[model samples]
Structure formats: C-alpha cells, structure tokens
Target chain A: MKSLIDICDLSREEIDSLLDTANDIIAHPEVYSEKCRGKKLATLFFEPSTRTRLSFEAAMYELGGNVLGFSEAQSSSASKGESVADTARVVSCYADIIAMRHPKEGAPLVASMHASVPIINAGDGGHNHPTQTLADLLTIKREKGGFDGLTLGFCGDLKFGRTVHSLIAAMSRYKDIRVVLISPQELKLPSYVKRDILQKNGIPYTQTTDFESVIDSLDILYMTRVQRERFFSEEEYLRLKDSYILTPEKLRRAKSDLCVMHPLPRVNEISTAIDNDPRACYFKQVLYGKYMRMALILMLLGVN
Target chain B: MNIDSIKDGIVIDHIQSGKCMEIYRLLDLEKLDCQIAIIKNALSQKMGRKDIIKIDAAIELDFDLLGYVAPGVTIDIIRGGVLVEKKTPELPEKIVGVICCKNPRCISTTEQELPQVFRLADRERRIYRCFYCESMSK
Candidate 1:
C-alpha cells in the first residue's frame, strides 16, 4: 500500500504528476465526476478538525464516492480505547481508502502498518501534514509556474509549523531555491531541519528576526500562526503570538507579485484588510487544497 | 586490583571512561545472576582512561543498545579460557525498545504495546531520531 505519511514519501515526479492531475481536475471537473464511483472513503479523524475532514469528504463526494467515519475520537470507538491499528484494520474492510487525523504523531503510520488500503495522513499532531504540503505545492506551481529559482520567505512559528518543514523538505530538491526564515529566536526553525534538509541539499538560506527587511526579496511569503496547541505554556504562546502581523503597510516594500499565504484559521497574524490585496493567496490555498485532495484520492484509488 | 579471567565469558573493553555504568544499566546487567565485574577509569595506551566490563557468563546481549550507548567498544568472547571471537558493535540502522521517545505527542508514548523505535539519522553526529516523531534522541 502506498500511504503518504510524509511529504518526502512522494518524489518530485510523483508530486508533478499529482499537480498535473489537479490541474486536469480543475480544467474538467465533469470528466472525473465518476472516477471513484462505487468506491468508499473512510475519514478516521481521532482529533477535531473542520477544514481537513470537510476537504476529504468533499473530495470523495466530488469523485462520486461514498464517505463514512467519525469526526472525532469521542464519536468513534477510540473513545472506548480501541487501538489505531485495530481501527485501521476494521475500516479497511469498509473503505477503499482512509484519510486519518490524530492528536498523536505517527498515529497514521501505525494505521498504515495494519490498514489494507492506503492511508492519507491529514495531520498528525505537530509532526507531518503532507497533504497540506501538496496543496502548497500546487498553489506555488499555479502561481510561480515552477519550483526552481524562487526565494521563499517563511514567517512565524517555524518551530511547530509542520507545513513549513514539509514544504522546505519538498522544495529542497529543486534547484536555485533560496530560503529566508523569518521568526523570533524562540520559534525559529528547528536545527535538524536546517541541517538535514537545507544545508545537506546545499540550498542557500538566511535566518533573520526582521521580517520586513527581507519581505521585498521573496517570491512566496508563507505566514504561519503561532499555534497554541503546540505550546506547553500559555505565557510563551502569548509572548510570541503577535510577533509578526502581515498588514498592507508591510507589503509596501514587497514585490507586487509576491504571493502571501497562510494555512488558514488565521488569528490576527494576517490583517483582514490585506485579504483584498490581490497578493493574498491564503483563501485560494484552501480551494487549491480541495483540488489537490481530489487528485490524491484518484491517485491513491488508482482511478486516475 | 586484579580481576580473575573468566573460563567462559565476555569482556567489553575500551568504553569511554565513566560510561560503563550507563551501559550496565541499559543492558540490565544487574538482573543477571552470573558474576559481573566493572572496572572504571582503567589506564589505556589508546585512551587516557577507559572502562571495562567482564561478565562471567556467555549471555546474550543487545548489540544495538551496546552500539548506541558505547560505539567503538570491543567485545571479546572466551570459551574454556581460550579466546573465541572478538566483535565490535556498529551503529545499528534501527533500535527497538532501547530508548523511549521523550516527545509527549509521539504515538509510542500513548500506545502501551507499541515498541519504541529510533533510527540512526546522522552517523557523524551519532544522532538517533524517533521513528514515530523524528525527534532527536537526547
């Protein structure tokens, strides 16, 4: 079974193919309306997630497949202390594929070990959210036309931002990709990520506390929220939550074609006034996320 | 300070000084009923000081744990007071149930039956990352 537990699990060619399929799905949605006919998708969310669960359900429905499974652990057998392996084995009998989200890291990996069908990791604690990286990739492909020779600026909460880590890992394979990491000292990108992904790949990078000074040089500005769920202390979260706020004034020095993005559910990190600024692609990222999910479902089911 | 040579046993040599206790603890040497000797801060020509452990029984050992805790240490096997074989444990590709992942969000933490697994991520740095969460082993 080919389960996407991490972004690195997919090669550059595979990602390109997924992007191609997503583009095709966007161009002609009717052609793939029956791609997954008679198939079933089980959304096994052990944690509360609105966007990811809905996106998976919506993708399956669009592919003419039936969707089942619980929205949270409280509603599922997990509440009764059922193991993830057992749940996966049981769900594999009903669904052709499984999209799982859990509070614990590597929960989906445990599921994939026992699942007869492919397991898509929607999100696993603060470890990995590969599909979100897929969405970011597709959005970047659509905006910049390719992954090479781009200066990408990642701002805020890089420590716990799984999307940023995964994307950097994915983008490191491309040529001439320069990274500008903008965050406070407290939430800087993890050293392992810098050493393993960036430095090992010979990708030039700059780490800075000043966001605006480097904003003008970036092609893509990925703004992330300071996630409270990732922090152990509320005091620390409060101290770093308002570190970087993307206002219209902040973009004055940035390029007109700069693509500003966020993973969504923004809590004042991105100003509402900048949503109309044509440069803000965060909402579009959500839409692109759905199309990429649809493409992923088709590929995983071998219906594409 | 002379320790008698065992008739049939294993001698672990050249452990970095002061690391024998950790290896002894991790290897659960205290659980064994056989005679065990730990010589700490022994003078060495190669190393300024080293530690050696001698077990008076040819017992099975967890080489992965040994490799992780004390790399480059030599293991000498003896049978009938004659040298049988000498082995050096290499950094294992994967280690299971050797060390628990400290990441609170790792699945191995909540799953009681799950085996704690860590993979060697960097050889030069001797870094082991949790297989479940990829957090660096401290």
Candidate 2:
C-alpha cells in the first residue's frame, strides 16, 4: 500500500497531480462531496495538535467519510502500553485509511510498515510532515503560478521548524529555485540539511541574519515561529526573538509580489497588521491546506 | 613470537590499527566459544601497522558490517590449514542495527523495537544517515 512517510515519498509527478486535484476541488467542491461516502478515516494523534488533527478531520468529512480515533495518547490504548505496530494492525481493521500524528519520529512509519491500509503521517516530531509540505506546495503554486525560478526565503527558526525543513526538501527538487535562509545564529538551519538537501541538489542558498536586506529579492517568504520553549534562557530568547519578526516596516522592504506564508498557530513572529496586506497569503494557506489534504486523502484512499 | 595460523576458521587481516576492538564488539565475537586471537598493532609490509583477528572455528561474518567498519580488511577462510578463499568485502548499500541514531527526536529512540537502519547517503564521503530520520551518523 502507498503511504506518505516523507515529502520525497511522492514524486514530482505525484505532487503535481495532487495539486491539480486540489485545484479541481477548489473549483468544484460539491463534486467531491460524495467521493468517499462509505470510507472511514482513523486519526490516531498521539500528540496534541489542534490545526493538523482538525485539518485531517475536516478533509475526511469533506470527502463524505467519517472520522474516528483518539486525539491524544492518554485517551487511547497507547496509555495502556499498546505498541504502534499493534495499534496500527488493530486500527487498520477498522478504518479505510489512517492519519497519525505522533511525538515520536517514525512512529507513523512503524505503523505504515504493519498497517493493512495506507498510513498518512500527520506530524512526526521534528521530522518530516509530508502533508504540510503538500499544502505549502499548493499555496506556492497558487500564489506564484509555478515552482520554477522562484527565490524562496525562509525566516525564523529553520533548525526546529519541520515546515521549513520540509519545504526546503520539497522545493530543492524544482528548477531554478534559490533559498535565502533568514534566522538568528542560534536557530540556523542544520548542517545535515544543508549538506543532504541543498548542497547535494546544488541549489544555491544564502544565509543571513538580516531579513530586510534580502526580502526584496525573494518571491516567497516563509515565516516560522521561534518558540521560547526551545531557549535555555529567557534573556537569550528575548534577544533573538525580534530579529526575524515580520513587521510592517520589514514588509515595506519586501517585494510587492512577495508571498508571505506561515504554518499557523503562529506566535509573535508575524505581526497581525500584515494580515491586511495584499501579499499576505498565510490565511489563504490555511484554506489551501484543507484542499490539499482533501486531495491527499483521496489519493491515499485511491479514490481518484 | 609468531601467531599460529588457523586450521579451520577465518582470519581477518590488514584491519586498520586500533579498529579491531570496535569490529569485534560489533561482530559480537565475545559470544563465540571458538578460539579467537586478536593481534593489534602488528607490523605489516604494506601498512606500517595493522590488526589481525584469527578465529579457530568457521563462523559466518557480516561482510557488509566488516566493509563498513574497515573496508580494506582481508578475510581468508582456512580449511585443514589451507587458505580456501581470500576476499575483501565491499560496503553495503544499507546497514541495519549497527549504528544507533543519536537524534533525540528520532523515532527509533522512542519506539525501541524499530531497527536502527542507515543508508549510504554519500558513497564518496562514506556518510550514512538514519533511514527513518535522515540524520547523518558520524
């Protein structure tokens, strides 16, 4: 069975097909209302996620499928010490497809290994989240028209932001794509990613602490929150927190067509005032997430 | 003093000096009941110094792991005090349960039952990354 354990699990052709399906769903949502009418979706979220879990639930419901499974590990048999493989084996008997979000990296992968049905990784620790990458790709496609020759800038915590890492991994596969990594020195992109994804693919990227100097050259500016929880000291967090904040003043220096994006439940990294800007596509990103997820759910279930 | 040759077993020769213990531990040579000889820092004509391990009972070695740990080591199979086969193992494309991924967020750390699998990410650099999390192993 096909499962999305990582962004690269889907080829470029598959990604485009998913995007095309998303676009079709956007144009005619009612046509897909009864697509998976008798299907069942199991959402096994071991971690507490509001947006991602809800997104999957919403996508499944929109596809005329019912959703089941626990939102937290404590509420499930996982608290009783059921293994992921066992859980997957049991859950596969109940659901047509499974979307799992776990705090442990590769928990979904273990489930995928044993699951009789297709397993979609909702979120797996700081590792890959292929669905979010799908949403990001759809947003990029809609906002920028195409993936080619786009200069993408990623700001804030690149090291811990799974979204940033996944996006970089996805975009590096495209043509003429350059990345500008904007982060404080404390939250720089991991060297392994730079080596494995960017350098290996020969994608040109520039690292900068200053976001304003390079904002104008970017076609897409992906912003990520730098959590205070990752900091050892309040002082260090405060010192570096505002360095990548997207203020109105900062947006003034960015390109007029620059698409500003954030994986939501954002903190102070993106100023609320920028929501009114014509270039702010983050809200649209949330809606695009739903459509893309619907596309993903359909594809995973082999429902066309 | 000369180390005696094995009669019916395997002799691992030309291991880079100081890499024998790691290879031995990885291969779990301690579990073997057969006579084992470890000659460390032995003088070699080709290499200035080398390590050799001679096992006096025929035992199957994980050649993939041997190639990964010390690529150029020579392995000779002995039967009735005659060298039956001589070969150098090549690096395997994938390695399982050898190097543990140290990434704290990696799933193998939590799942415990998952195999610690690694794939050769860069052959030229001899770099392997955790197959699940893609974290590079040093």
Candidate 3:
C-alpha cells in the first residue's frame, strides 16, 4: 500500500510481516540503527498530541533519521489558511514520509491524495488510529502469544475511542475472536461498527454495561479513558468516569492471565495501583508503539 | 398535448414518477441553455408511471449516476430529428461528488476539497459506504 490510512489497509499477511519486522527491530537495535541514516520524517500534527507526535519522532530518530514539523496548528501554515492538500504537497518535497494528526476525521486521507510520499494517520478526530492498533497488536502478540481463540473485553468510552474502534476492526481479521464490549449506554460502541465490521464479518460479540460480569472470561481487557471532552457536561463525565475504572478489586474477578491494555494519556479509567501488575501491558505497549512505528517507517520508506 | 421532440439532444426516460424533481435539481437542469421538458406521470407499459426528461442540447450525461438515483433509467440520444443511440444504465460501482457522507466523523465532512465518494458495499440491500471513513451514506 502507498499509505497507512486505516488498519484494514494492511492485509493479514502484511500485518504479520510488520509484526515480524517489529520483533527484529526489538531483537537487534544496533544492526538497524543506521537504516534510515539520511532519510527524513515530517510530523504534521494539526492537532495537539504530545504522545503520538513524540512516538513518530522517536521512531525516526532511533532509525538514524531526522524529524521535522509543527506540533500544533497555530505554529503551522494551516492557521494561515493553507489546505492539507497544499501542506502535504509541500512537505512531501522535504520529507521521505509524513505522519499527520488532525482534528478532522479524513485530513490524513486528503494529505495522502496530494502527497507524493507515504502519509500515516497519527490520530484523526475519533475516526481511525492505525499505528495505535499496530502497537496494540504487537502487545497482544507478546502478552497473549497470538490473536486466535481469545476473548477481548473493551471498557469505557467505546463510542469516541478511536483506538478501540481500530483494534476491534483489526482483531476481526483473526480467527475465533470474540469481543465483549463493556460501556455505559451513552458510551456504547457505535452501531455502524457492530453492523459493518462485526456482524458483516460474522464475528461473534456481546455488549454489556457491566464489566464485572464478563471480566473472568476475557483474555485481554482494554481500558479506555472516559474523556470529559466527549460528554455534554462535566456532571455526565463524572457520573460515567468512575463506572468503568479498572481497580484492584475489579481485577480480582478478572482472569489470572488477562492482559490489561490501554491507549495511554489516560484520565482515571485505570487505577495507578495496577501499574506494577505483570498483566498491565499498557506501558510495554508504549515502548512497542515506538518499535511498531520504526517498522512502519522502514517498511514505508522501503529500507532494510 | 405533446411536448415537442428534440432534434439534437438527450432524453432521460423511465425515472420513477415522483422523483423527477430530485433528478432535475441534481442534474442542474434549470441552468441549461437548451429547451428542457419534464414529462411527469407518463403512461408506460414497462412501468405503471414514469418520468421523462428531454433536453434540446447534447450535454454530457452521467448514465451511471442516473442509474444510481433511478435504477431503471434509460438514456436515448437524438440526432437529425431521429433516435441515434439507446442506453439502459446500470448502477455504478462507485459514485463521486454526488452524495455527501452524513457521518459526522467522516473525513469528507471536514475536507471540503475532497470529493465525497461512496462505493456499493451490498448490492442486495442497496447499501453504500463512504470511501474515506467507511460510514453508510444516507
């Protein structure tokens, strides 16, 4: 593929190859240090995302490449009325690859259309985050051994959580996968997702408002931040935020081998006390984020 | 009373009767310099009631698009006061810049320059999904 706009953009074989490459990068970091020695990466973050922007920059730096671009829209030409198409066209001249995070849902797709180089969607609105899905995949492979025959439980704000949407779509391609969606009424997974991706693929899934009831059957529990920004009022956010928190008491009911996952920059959905727990793989997921990005850059640039 | 036939123009026939106004607005028929006639509730053997549009100008017509809106549409080309070509349009595999995706999270909603494209996902259900965000196009 010319660009990575969505998780489905990569085939099952391609996803497997990317995971293999990530494993290689983790194994022999020294051997691949200078792989992109003279190449450059442009991170055009129209939205403010410190974690995703830094992950892309760090990935490029580890490959012996340079990084450039603005972290926010005010600092870039976007504020001066330059379109994403024009910005992508201009940046493609200066960089070998471009990673973009925009508040608009399809801004990266627009950039990909105009850009000569590869355009990776860092995080676009609440639409899709393919790289985060990659990190989640790598972590799942490491913690659960494989994707087959696993019950994954997703908790908290599934409606606006891009990571949850992306991970579920990616995991649907695997064998014997069952998804348990745990969320409040307002935060339930969008019906289009359940209809298009899950039901259309014939993948079995169950939805519930209670996490305790389904905790023991899950092999992986993905916790998500119940963002204050997603709610209409602060009172509503407060009411739902504490409902899905993954506390030690809640963990008692979960499977012993359950791998607790989360796309970080969390806002109280997961208790900090579980940070030391071996089953909490979110921190390792952060490290894997860099490795997966390294593999993504290498693959996109066609470097060894 | 009969609407005068066009000597050199295009004829869009077999549209579902009540949908003529929608097709007229979509095709921007009001802006055309040629003589145009909207024949509504025309008696037909194939269809009980149909709409026919005849334009006295040879403009480029999107047959696939016409088929998408009204699947049973037929296009006829007239030259030298006689019918030269006849066409029955099929539903297009994908429609570009025709219908906007109503999904708020769709990329096309924000990227004003990008053409709103939809691909036929389920033929039996007549379902179309946006090309960018994969949301159903209403």
Against the reference, the lDDT scores of all candidates come to 0.93, 0.90, 0.89
lDDT tens readout by residue for model 2, A193-296: 89989998999999999888998999999999876655668998788777767899989988899999999778888889999999999989988999999999
lDDT of 3 by residue, A1-304 (tens): 4899998889999899999999999999998899999999999998899999999999999999999999999999989888888999999999999999987777888899899999999988777899999999999998888999999999989998889988999999999999999999989999878987899888899999988899999999999998776566898877877777888998998788999999998877888999998889999999999999999999999997
Per-residue lDDT of model 3, residues B1-138, tens digit only: 599889999999999989888898888888888789999999999999899989999778666777678887888999988999999876678999888888776667655477888998877678888887767777
Q: Model 1 off-target regions past 4 Å? A: B4-9, B16-50, B55-62, B78-85
TM-score of each: 0.93, 0.93, 0.89
Q: Of the candidates numbered 1 and 2, which has the greater TM-score value?
A: 1
The DockQ leader among the candidates is 1
Question: Can you tell me the CAPRI class of model 1?
Answer: medium
| Superposition error at A115 for model 1 (Å) | 1.2
Clash pairs detected, candidate 1: none
List the candidate numbers ranked by lDDT, top first: 1, 2, 3
True contacts kept of each: 0.75, 0.71, 0.62
- Among all windows of ten consecutive residues in candidate 3 chain B, which has the lowest summed lDDT? B103-112
lDDT against true structure, model 1: 0.93
Please tell me which model should have the higher lDDT, number 1 or number 3.
Answer: 1
